[model samples]
Target: MSYSPTIYKFADGGGAPVAPEMALVRAVLEPHDVGDPQLTVGEDGSLRFWIRASDDSEAEISADETGILVERPQTGGVFAIVAELVTKLGAVIIDPASGRAVCRAEEQTRLPADMREEAIVIDMTGDALEAALLGPRIAVGPSPRAAR
Candidate 1:
């Protein structure tokens, strides 16, 4: 069976499509002990994951061609996880507020100067997830009774 996130739409009636990039993002996030991860697609084709940022606050990480967008009521603890994801995906975090690359300075060079000023760009292609989909499959040999 394949993994697909439950789809949802914004109040504005816009929603994103299910894309392979989301699977890659989920693959990168699966091993973490972070709160139960919930994936959602936005109207603009952005994939987002929701998690608890704190006892009282919620956070969301949205990924698109531009990169990932980290949104939280408070960025304190959530930023660490965002940073880790940036590193794992060979991407960079861009602070939308300041319009600057805030983490993974080395990866900043990968994005065009214009995009660097916008979204947090995770430098991953859908190809990054090709391996995850190729899990080992069991061969269906003849049933025991049939063999007998």
Candidate 2:
């Protein structure tokens, strides 16, 4: 069967779409553990992540200036990560095919098993998170997940 991409985006902050800010990016990714193909965010405001399901299906995530696009999200981990980040960033999960918000920010969505233990949802203020990002050691824990 064919599959559609899933998108995670910020609710219109103004009259326009908003991309994720650095702190939001850090908050969402720093404590996340995606195993081998960990999510990578570029200094230029780009992101890339690949997900491989237990069923052997694979998906790729791409980001534009507006939001994150998950291509062919065949795994629950895909939504798990999205749910985590959506809650953290105050964003929402968009069903690309329908162009609707399936999951709203801060809503209690369940995490998939593969991600339940690995995912560490953040509760830091922007100033605190920024501080942790700059310091020799992070307050959250070990250094934020390697971007590489």
Candidate 3:
């Protein structure tokens, strides 16, 4: 019941964003099975979506500049969003605390092992990105749920 937005930056290049942005939401359901849908933004700036049962864990999914590519992973359970054009240069982590979600940039520019408890939230853009790119500080904002 929480939404965290995190912005990732490309290390080598510093221009137009060529990386895909992903947002995952989870909800409780019956034993029959039900899971939250995944949200993805392609490099070309297109929206892609998918729905899967909570029981089906492995679902192969790719969200790149072209769009969304749906496939079932051989491993089974847990869908993997492929980064074709965007290399996922870096990632941010956002956590819900009190009434706000704290957004923090990765210390090493990679997705950490613990993503559930520590996720990333993207709350700033344009000038905000400029400032963050300079100092690399955490962004705090009202929870997307609370904003409404």
Candidate 4:
């Protein structure tokens, strides 16, 4: 995980914020606001939060006047948090690395074809393993395990 955070903000119309300062703060903090936290305020006045991603994993989630940050993520799983902010503030994500739009469906589909095939082999998200395992690009067939 990089020390840098994955930011969420409006891509254009930069004069005013997407929402009121307080509402932006509330929207980002409210969901993760449970329990006491040793919050810190940066020189820029941004607030940082520490969150538990799982029993064995922990993460930092933060909010500021400009936008929110999901910092040092291991996987893109945490990107789901941006969905609410997108709806609430009408904000779009800027990929920290690419500096381009992040929330669009096309971004998700840009994975290489070989990786998509590996996903089928590993049963990552889609249910095409039954077909993928049968042969190259075959249509889905009954799972061999289903016969058991």
Candidate 5:
């Protein structure tokens, strides 16, 4: 089953732009060293890194002037690692599910309706991630058994 990966944004206090440095990100992930880390910096000054778990699951994190973006296949505990890095960066975790930002208490705001349907929506404020994780599976179509 294919599931939309959850998105987590990181920001500093006072809503300042914070770019997660590659060095720091590497250091933070050293302990969980799965293998050689793949890091790249885009022309737009965005930093991206990919780390593969021993189980072959991979997690990718990208950070730009706006904030850090985390994407993982499914709830394979990769977020826990991302969460730790967020805490280390001293940045706030904006969980879209709660309607309010986490890591630093803030007012609740709902993402625009259009963004809510997009595969990779940027505006974070809800528990869509958690809900997807806990919610029932969505059947893509008729099962093979049914077809038979």
Candidate 6:
């Protein structure tokens, strides 16, 4: 008998496609521990585009120490958004601000230069998460047992 892996991509209601701002907020804040001086995600989409953080395990985070807990925004995209947020907020300060500090992929610069430090700055501990959510991630295959 022969078996072959298959790939499938699909979208869902998924509790309403989180708004761009909210998605960015989620991507930005979902990477820190509780009460870790970081913002959090709220239920009511009142102001989705605020900021937040998390503190997952080493294996569960990106190199930049972001999230791998509750999946939402695309890993790389999330990381880009967060990195950009960090850069904007002066978190990962890169005096040069070149190379990985900023990528030349996204159309409009991911993070702006006016991101308020008060808006960002959470305690998302770990590097995997940072890598997974705030580093350079590339889209790959879909899950074999996804709820699509």
lDDT, residue 39, candidate 6 = 26
Writing each residue's lDDT as its tens digit, candidate 4 over 41-70 gives 567676766543323234466666666666
For model 5, the run of ten residues with the poorest summed lDDT: 104-113
User: Of the candidates numbered 2 and 6, which has the greater lDDT value?
Assistant: 2
In angstroms, the error of model 4 at 107 is 15
Q: What are the C-alpha RMSDs, in order, of all predicted structures?
A: 16.8, 15.2, 15.1, 10.9, 8.2, 17.5
Q: What is the TM-score of each candidate against the true structure?
A: 0.45, 0.49, 0.24, 0.46, 0.49, 0.21
- Residue 100 deviation, candidate 4, in Å? 0.6
- Candidate 2's displacement at residue 17, Å, is 1.4
**Model 2 agreement with the true structure over 1-148: per-residue lDDT tens digits:** 4445443443333433466664665555444434343437666767765655444445565665777765665443444555555556665444444443443323213333332343323443322222222223334545556543
Backbone steric clashes in candidate 4, count: 0
Off by over 4 Å in 2: 1-8, 11-13, 26-43, 52-58, 105-148
Relative to the true structure, candidate 5 reaches a TM of 0.49
Provide the lDDT at 11 for model 5. Answer: 31
Candidate 6 off by > 4 Å? 1-46, 50-71, 92-148
User: Which one is best on lDDT?
Assistant: 5
As for TM-score, the candidate ahead, 3 or 5, is 5
- Which ten-residue region of model 2 has the weakest summed lDDT? 126-135
lDDT of 2: 0.47
- In Å, residue 146's CA in model 1 sits off its true spot by 79
Better of 5 and 6 by TM-score: 5
After superposing candidate 4, which stretches have Cα over 4 Å from the reference? 1-5, 11-20, 33-45, 53-58, 104-148
